[model samples]
Target: MPRIVLATHNPHKVEEFQAIVAEVRPDLDVVAYDGPEPVEDGVTFAANALIKARAAAAHTGLPALADDSGIAVDVLGGSPGVFSAYWAGHKKDSAANLELLLDQLSDVADPHRTAQFVSVIALVRSDGTEETIEGRWPGRLAVQPAGPGGFGYDPIFVPDGQPADAERTVGEWSAAEKNASSHRSRAFVALAPLLESL
Candidate 1:
């Protein structure tokens, strides 16, 4: 089986990508990256994702996959688009990031608190060839965080158009449920065939 590098230092991300890939392309093996993390200086999701994937591909001399994702608030005009992880501070503290965002939108009325989780997945090969795909999870922001299922800003995100039976926040959904329709999951679904062909 061909081993592919999932270019992320976050163990959670590595696990998620591996599981997502295994479900569709069992022939491929996903491995954790053990290389230097690239400086994500890009202004857009695709650019940042490519930066990481290219770095991993160069370091590992193999196919590499990387993701750049964030929550874009409608009211903030996507101020935190590529800066989601550092919204609160540079340390990438999840609780601090979530708390900061909540405080920023504390006074905003429910109707104007629309937002979406954006993910850009980049796949790069050793020869420097690459492909980028995007996925969006549209939803409104909650007044406060809830549940404890997901990471990042999941608790404050109320995924749009969820059935009443389903949980409102991504943090409240089961792993299977979130994986079935998450932004990353959708992006990987589109990127899976490309991996299979590789």
Candidate 2:
């Protein structure tokens, strides 16, 4: 299999992207990157993803894939869009971030609690060729976190289109189900064809 570097130290992102990419091109191998982390100072997911990918590709001289993802609340004016990981503070504490978000929305009505998970995936080659794609999963925030599956804001996110009687948060969904419909997966759906052409 052809090997490529993935520009992230996060195990969750490595696992998620590996699985999602494998679904499209199992012959490719998504390897971990060991380069220094880039400053994700970009204000948008696509910009950040590109920054990481470009840095990795420049550092390793290998095709690099990167992703920037976050949960954006409709009422928050897309706040925490790029700062989702550090929503509570600069610590990037998932639990604290989740807690702070929950508390901040404590007074928000259920109807106005709408939000979406956004993912932007970037790929850069040794020659500096690049492309980025995005995906969004529309959902609403639950009153409180629930279920034990998934990481980040999954516990508080209930996707739309669920049956009224069988509602479940992203945190409650099976890995297969989540992978099939996740924002990352959707983004990769657009990215996979580009990979094939490369």
Candidate 3:
């Protein structure tokens, strides 16, 4: 099977993307990248994704896929977009980041707590073929964190499409459920056709 490198050192992302890709293109193999991390100086998600994808493609001499994703709170004016990981500090503590976000929106009403998970995936081939795809999962922020699954802001993000009275956060959903309808999944679905050429 042809192999593609996922431009990330994060194990969670590697597992997540592997699962997502397998559903679309079972013939392709996805591998985690072990290259030196590139500076994601880009302000937009697409720019950051391309930066990482380009670095991985150059380093491994293979086609690379990279995704830059974060929760964009509508009320906060989409703040912490690229800075989601380091929202609290430079340490990138998930708990701290989640706490800080919840605290910041404590006073906001439910109707105004709308947010969305945004993902931008970039595909870069060693031969200079490059493409970027995007996906956005609309939702609202819960008053407090719940469930024990998922990573990052999953615990507090109540995705749309659930029954209004019985909404469940991504953290409460199983890995299979998340992989089927997550922002990364949506973006990967968009990127599936491109993988056929490889």
Candidate 4:
């Protein structure tokens, strides 16, 4: 099978991407990148994704896929968009980031707690060609974190389309369910056709 480097050192991302990619391109192998991480100084998700993808492709001489994703609260004017991972500090503490976000929006009413999970996946071929695809999962933030299935803001994010009286956070969903309907999955789906050429 062909191999594609996924530009990330995070194990969670590696496993998640493997599951998502397997569904669309079972023949392709998604490998974790052990190369040096480039400075993601870009202000947007697409820019940061490309930076990583470019670095991975240069290091591995293979097609590289990198994604920059975050939770963007509508009430915050999309703040913490590119800063999602470092919301609390440069440590990239998931719990701290979640706490800080919830505290910031503590006063916001339920109807005003609208938010969206955004993901941008960039693909870089070894030959230097590059492309980006984006996906957004709209939802509202819960008052407190719930469930234990996901990382980062998943526990507090109640995805849309759930029964109003029985809404469930992404953290409450099974891995299979999340893999089928996450921002990453959506972005990867859009990039699937492009992968065929790799």
Give per-residue lDDT, candidate 2, residue 64.
Answer: 91
lDDT per residue as tens, model 1, 1-198: 889899999998887887788788888889999999889999999999999999999999989999999999999998689999999889999899889999999999999999999999999987778999999989998887788898999888999887767647888887777888889998999888787667
- Residue 47 in candidate 2 has what lDDT? 97
Q: What TM-score, over all chains together, does every model reach?
A: 0.96, 0.98, 0.99, 0.99
Q: Write the per-residue lDDT of candidate 4 for residues 60-165, one digit (tens) a residue.
A: 9999999999999999999789999999999999999999999999999999999999999999987889999999999999999999898999999999998989
lDDT (Cα, tens digit) per residue for candidate 3, span 42-67: 99999999999999999999999999
Alpha carbon lDDT of each predicted model? 0.89, 0.92, 0.95, 0.95
Query: Which regions of candidate 1 fall more than 4 Å away from where they truly are?
Result: 164-167
* lDDT, model 1: 0.89
lDDT of 4: 0.95
State in Å the error of residue 6, model 2.
1.0
